[model samples]
Target: MRRSRLGRFGSRLQSRSWPRFVPRFVPRFLRCLWPDTLFGRLVMILAIGMFAGQVLTSTIWFDTHESRTLEVPARLFASRLADTARLIALAPDDAARRALAQQLGDPKYQIAWIAAKAPGVDATSTAGFRREPIVQRVIGDLIRGVLARRLGAPPEIRLLEANVHDDSGKRGGILNLFDSPMPTGDFHVQLKLHGTGWSGWLDVRANEGQADALTEPHSLALDYLVRIYLIRFTAVCVLAFIAVRFAVQPLRQLAKAAEALGRNIHRPPLPVTGPSEVRSAAQSFNAMQQQLADSIAQRTRFLTAVSHDLRSPLTRLRLRAEMLPDPVWRERLRGDLDEMEAMVTSTLDAVQGIEITETRHEIDLDSMLEGLAQDLREAGHAVSIAGRAGRPVPGYPRNLKRCLQNLLDNAVRYGERADVQITDTGRSVRIVISDRGPGIADAALRERVFEPYVRLASKEGTGLGLTISRSIAAAHGGTLTLENRAERGLDAVLSLPRED
Candidate 1:
């Protein structure tokens, strides 16, 4: 029970700590292993697939073709050497033996007599990544078996050069090619006669010049192996890259069109081309854009008409209130009439501001802010502007200026002072407008304050200022948000995306 409790406690502790530790560690490794872009990811996948395919192909080829081709020559050479030893031993004299040796010498196997002891055998040196010692061992075993059957005992044998050797008559460790059209080498052996002092060296090579279908050594050539893999892998990689690029082109165009539409709702619809899926997406996007434009137009016209129709009655009511006999009643009616008129005007202005048709241009926001600050200071408000955007942003000059003006007005009215700062992040610009004032008590009410006509108890505006300002910022592919400062006051942050 105690162990179980301990285990449970440990698990609970680990679970609590998991989030903090895993986020920092896992993402670094994931970033290193994973490709960042679509193109890179596709290429990486293709490379891995190609490598696996090559590995499988090499395994199959070596198992079936290479092993069979090399083994046949070793077996045949062993048999021939055994036959020659038998014939030389059967010959009556030296002259007769010499003649028999000459007769037995064929294009594939050559016999030469040598008077010396058998050379030392180094088994380990005979086999490696590039050398096959098993081939020589099999051949030696076959020769010894044949001699044992004929002579009643195995003859003394030494492997002078049982493995593949270059044209220079030396064992060329690895990656050495014999001078020929196809990679060729000699399989040689030297053995001593039982009673005679003479030792015979039997030289067996892979069939003269033309490698037969069964005995071809072309597969073993270093150049042939390298060229086949290099050329094949390179071609596969290029083809895979082209195929993947073509497949993702439609998606790239769709993303670009979406970004552009965000900047300007009036931008042209995407071209409905390419594959069936892409065409369907483009058609849907076009329909949605059309619907949104129609809805905005209809809403704008409704607001304009409502504002116009309400003005006549509001004017009449104001005039009638002024003529009232009771002083208190007359003043109260006049104030109500004035408030109604202000609401109508504010609504009309907000609607008009959002439906701006100003052309986009590269404007230096830093200069504009400085000029606006100077104007505000001239109007007897304390305004301080700090920090400047490094690059000009693409936007409507009039609408953007109006948006900034509303924010500055709000700051001065509520906080009594405006502090503005701008930061450029290459792709976007952030403008922070802060004021030292009584901030919103409820954090939830901060977002609700942007709603039209929803003024705070202490504020006296139509409350459409923030609503219109945010709309303008959004129309230019940006955002406007408000946050309560830790000390006192509210911070209004505006982010505008820069045109590349």
Candidate 2:
């Protein structure tokens, strides 16, 4: 029943980033112990609650446990006294009474006859006492009280005047000191016994674990308490971890699907399963992903249709340019026609980048860059590769090559030179392409340049290059960002995760 409630509770909690009830200004040490992950935090909260409950239960019941521990042995000792008195009463004389005392004595106790002493008790010691004198007093009282009831009369039951030999209890002993009736010291008891024409003292020293708490010290009590708590604490942690992890699994899957959605707009829809809340979330997510896919598909089709329709006219224009009478006129007309055609081609390419059809594979990035540099050199463009690309990146090989080509070509066109640097780490591979040109001083314009068809007045080409490059990078689960170099250039930093 509790598990069902926890599952429902976690369903609501899983959707939130942080619980509002949790205070923001937790102590630094406590914050350090707190986990960063959602799953860990949930488990930690559950474990703490369970551990506190166990501690509380131990405290509430301990008084009862302590009383029971002290009473059982105490009653048995009183019973032994009652039995001894009855046997002494049946004895014929003092000689038989003395013999009975020595007959049933154990190694831990000394039972012998002495002259009958006073009726009152003396549980006092001036010094050299570890256990409480009060605990010895309780032992004296319990024994005298129980023994009297069995004998049908109260007798002289006095304790010896000596150093009260005992030690303090282990756990919570001091807390309950004066108020508790439990004995934690031994009994060197001197009591009265009568036989036929014989009267004397039954002097016995009973070393009980409860009376002295000597044989069963407080340290042992502490050990038991600690051991039980540790075992339960461990179990609580383990159980909490398992339960929260299972309950929050669907949430994690939903998050992963959302993250992957941005990378692959056309990827398969999420499975609509699990708890009702999670299933609803998945359905909403899949619907949103479908809407985005349809939007991109419709846009691609529009661009493709426009490009296709313009191709026939572009072909006719090229044919007409071929018939120009003057060479200068023909060349200029041909260049104008070529620029128009390039605009159409770039627009189509930009749309196609969003709908990448190329299969993913591991491409040797260094070799791919070498190929790009070799091609650019043949085309009379100045380009240099300064560092290695380091690792095989999993991506669309053709789309990634095209993306790099556009960035490098822009660098060559504006800056007159391109310099590429590569760096690799466990998480990502970064490629920084630098150019020695006058960088865009306006930060807003630098970002604005990535918008389709937006270009600086002086630039001699369509502004779709960066847009297409960024789209390809996004599709490959990477990023392409521009930074104006400090001294005199612009750097295109392309960072890609090692995995897709």
* lDDT computed for candidate 2: 0.75
lDDT of 1 by residue, 1-500 (tens): 99999999778768863333222333454545655677767886787688678877764554333333334455555556667777877776656666777787876667765423335633223342233455545556755666667667777765544444433444433334313224333555666664455444433233322245332346556455676687778888888889888988888888888876765667778999988999999999999989987888899889989989999899898888888999999999988888888888888898778775667889899998988889999999999988889989999899999999999999998999999989888999999999999988687799898887788887898889999999999888899999999999989999998863
What's model 1's overall lDDT? 0.73
Report the error of model 1 at residue 366, Å: 3.1
Candidate 2 displacement at residue 122 in angstroms: 29
TM-score of each: 0.59, 0.64
Question: What is the C-alpha local distance difference test score of each model?
Answer: 0.73, 0.75
What pairs collide in candidate 2? 131-166, 170-218, 184-211, 185-211, 185-212
Prediction RMSDs, each to the true structure: 11.8, 10.3
For candidate 2, lDDT tens digit of each residue in 1-500?
A: 99999998888768755544244655544765777788978898899889878877875455444444456566666787778778766777666767877886786566876544434523232244334354455556777899889999887776552122233433235344333334443456667776555577777766554533433346555665567787778888999989999999998888888887777776678898888998899999989988988888888889899999999999999999999899999999999999999999977877786566656689889998889988989999888987776668888788899899898988988998999999888678899999998989999998898888999988877888898889888877888898999999999999989875
Error in Å for residue 116 of model 1: 44
